[model samples]
Target: MFHFRRSTAVACLALAPLVAQAQINVDSISQDALVSTPESVDCTLTDGSTATCLEITVKYVPENLEVGPFCPAMIDDIGGIWDWDGDEAGLYRIDAAFLTMLDEMGYHFYDEDGTVHVFDIRVEGPTDDNECISGSFDEAVEMTMLIPTTPVMADAPVSLGTVAKVGVSLSGVPVFADAPSALDTGHMPALDVCAGHVDPGGWYHYHGTATDLDTVYDHAGVEGSCANAIQDAKVQFGYAFDGFAIMGSLEHDGSVPRDLDECGGHVDGDTYHYHASEEFPNLPTCLVGLQAEDNYSTNAAGGIGAEGKGPGGQGGRPDFAAMAEALGVDEQLLARTLEEAGGPQADLAAVAAVLGVDEDALRAALPQRP
Candidate 1:
């Protein structure tokens, strides 16, 4: 597999002068992606300033878009894909050999009869131990996203972390930072050929810019590719939380941009925008502007919040405020610890030790999931 290396010629990320960004015209959104027509409304920025934003509610997948074959039936059969960071550390096909390799290292993904453990965690709920989870689709739930009509550049750029919430694609699907780590959660949410999966909330999202995955696939020697990615290298892929446009991996000339900043951003004419890389987690590395408060949300139980920054967890997730109060710890501290521990289903014993509490007590303090 080809290893990724940054060209030193690429400009390091630095604050650039803010250029006026155009408002997202509803026409740009694919008709199939929307559950309802977008609405422009007043909103608050993260900086406590007032701004207008476009409220967009999306459907599960784009019109006629098909994906999957995740979670193989047998150990030897190839199922989906994972951007593995350990044991070889490259894109891998989820076959029996891959599971066996992990199982040998004690991350059992199969039974003695070689039957791979598969679950629709969204329906069955999260587990205490590792299992391969592929979410089921839900049409009843709708996620509403708010992006400032005009982005406000931040005083300083911020790193995009796990599930970084990059922005929405042309198809109206959400584009995220990184998928939950199999290494961290013990559970694996296998991505289909295009490096996308159903979130536990039942919405479809991309962890990487599905466009131009071929570059990464070829580099990593991976066999499959994205199903609905824009093949036009120069075309815009999506928008970032900050409202900057995200381009496909290549320039209009079908050449890689050499001067991208740390956030994958560079000046494009009058506006500053980001570009996708031909690598895993191909979205922007950081946010260059201030986005709307409560930028993402859903009516679904596992949904993010309405006011801002949501619950940031799946359904049956423990309430942060209640758990923190019960644990007698700082809320911010507890939140950061759990995020660091790999999201909501973080290791309880490990978290207990960090908080200096008994594991059983911590578990009891957490809301019991059905």
Candidate 2:
């Protein structure tokens, strides 16, 4: 529900230097590396609408390894711990609360039982010992999403509600939704300065496109700054679940286009594509194109997407005690706070104010009650 906007002047200022110094790597990416053949599938939108979509499955690892030096230093700065137990076994860990929020939002992670867990810190790292804390490298995941062959706009702009995953980055990292689920309103996640962090599942994904490609380029032994690493001509970073291309902010001519819609989309020739912006919601804010069916649920055959039931299953309320423990708060205090604010019908901000914390923090801390 947060309306985000950025100063055009500031965006122009930040991009000008990068545009001049950075060059997108032309040989690094190819169509075959990122996308698969489009298949006709039935999909459902967030609004409970259904459509016949072109499902496109993509590799979890990007073709371009040069865009990621994703280092431990960056992770440490963001409060993430690698080799969490001090053993070199390569298990990563994050705040229990962060993991819990992901579950509440209906995103599932591989639990130790090989089923699913709501809050645990055992993240598996990439098999190849790369500098970046890339997850599931040995058995790379193939994710599939539905997109309409013909683009269509919704009657009203669909809100990107507590989005779990947005799209995949060109480097093959998963792109998370804009707002930080672990924090309250107006607060942001402690992401690596490069705009990415390691998930509890050990997946190294992005929340935006503010990464410094130079570090990645240097680590991969490729030449160029992060800015110039992506080809300036095409600037295709990745693809949305909706099957449209996700491009950088600048056009082929080195200028930000002015004709983009709310979802950062515009019809380029006959093709619909999205542009990454220099704002809070750096990527496209919503799916302007048609969406595919819910693939996050266990019922979905692939079960590789983020649009399904979480560990405890959808609609079943979470336990307050477990929720309180995950948020690092006292159960009694949380209950009292909720009661004073009107029990199950309390306003989140009101409860947070009474408890002297950010609304988002309080929200993330609370269980998903009916």
Candidate 3:
């Protein structure tokens, strides 16, 4: 149970600009051509046995091609070959020319297998054709370029309903949203959208994605992180990634952005895209930040729309079971506390504090103990 304060969230969003937020391209090639002399050649093994080999030649474009984010992963996906040995079927290196094509198309390398590998490539102008097979003479070949793989598929965009919990934090308190399986969107796909601009108290906030969350919090100033603390609050409950339902049934309705400056005191730029879910139920193309729904209100102790109940035994408070499940604690402990409360007022605030909820809301949940 991490105690999340507004300061923590604000600190994290300030570091967003420093992060690498670029998109990659692959599947594009720019090269002159491939030419081999004599077309084929004969090779002899250590035992003195000879075999026919093809002489593959290629000319690259741009002289230097950039490999996108998927290249390494794709190679690893099918299995990478370090040595220039096409001996095994389906193991072949794309000549430097082909790499240019992939780079042009935005292909990047990734290593999904959790194993790190290194690849290098050296580019040189075409010289004597004899030099092509020279490296094979002693089994020591000269090559250019070594490419490594990046972490691949660690996080995939999954529907909210399939995850055990939506990974998010609010006011620094991490709550699990685990109702995806039970809630049906009714043909409207829902996506959880957070305002990259303001906090629950209507303060300017930033940082919208998990990647940005880690960067901003760890690197930004404490004050900045505090402002964004509410951003972490979640509508879903649970640690399992599959707890919340994704609004997959959402439709893209083009609409102008609605300013939220009145609520959070910030002017977030407009946006236009597809969306579902109560948060950002309407896709505003002009104002991206305004499209977000204010899900952080649920955690306030005495707030009007707060979700979970407090430790006190009373009317609007959550049952011992629901509170236990939401907080990831044992139900018996809360149940016992409720019994020992003696009265609602004495026990309510204490219960909410322990449960990480607001005190006012906790008191509201408890029934008057006449």
Highest-scoring model, TM-score: 1
Top model number, lDDT: 1
Q: What are the Cα lDDT values of the candidates?
A: 0.73, 0.44, 0.23
Candidate 2: where is the Cα deviation over 4 Å? 1-38, 45-50, 57-120, 123-142, 161-164, 170-172, 179-194, 210-234, 268-271, 295-370
TM-scores for every predicted model: 0.87, 0.48, 0.16
Error of 3 at 12 (Å): 27
Model 2 per-residue lDDT tens digits across residues 188-277: 223443456433323345666534333333333333233413434236776666556777767767766777776777766556677876
Model 1 stretches with alpha carbons more than 4 Å out: 1-13, 125-129, 303-319, 333-347, 350-357
Clashing pairs in 1: 75-96, 294-308, 305-310
Query: What are the per-model numbers of colliding residue pairs?
Result: 3, 17, 102
Tens-digit lDDT track of model 1 for 137-234: 77776778998878778877767666657899887888877765676557787988777887665667887777667777877787876767656557
- Ranked by TM-score, the better of candidates 1 and 3 is 1
Worst 10 residues of 2 by lDDT: 12-21
Locate the minimum summed-lDDT window of 10 residues in model 3: 130-139
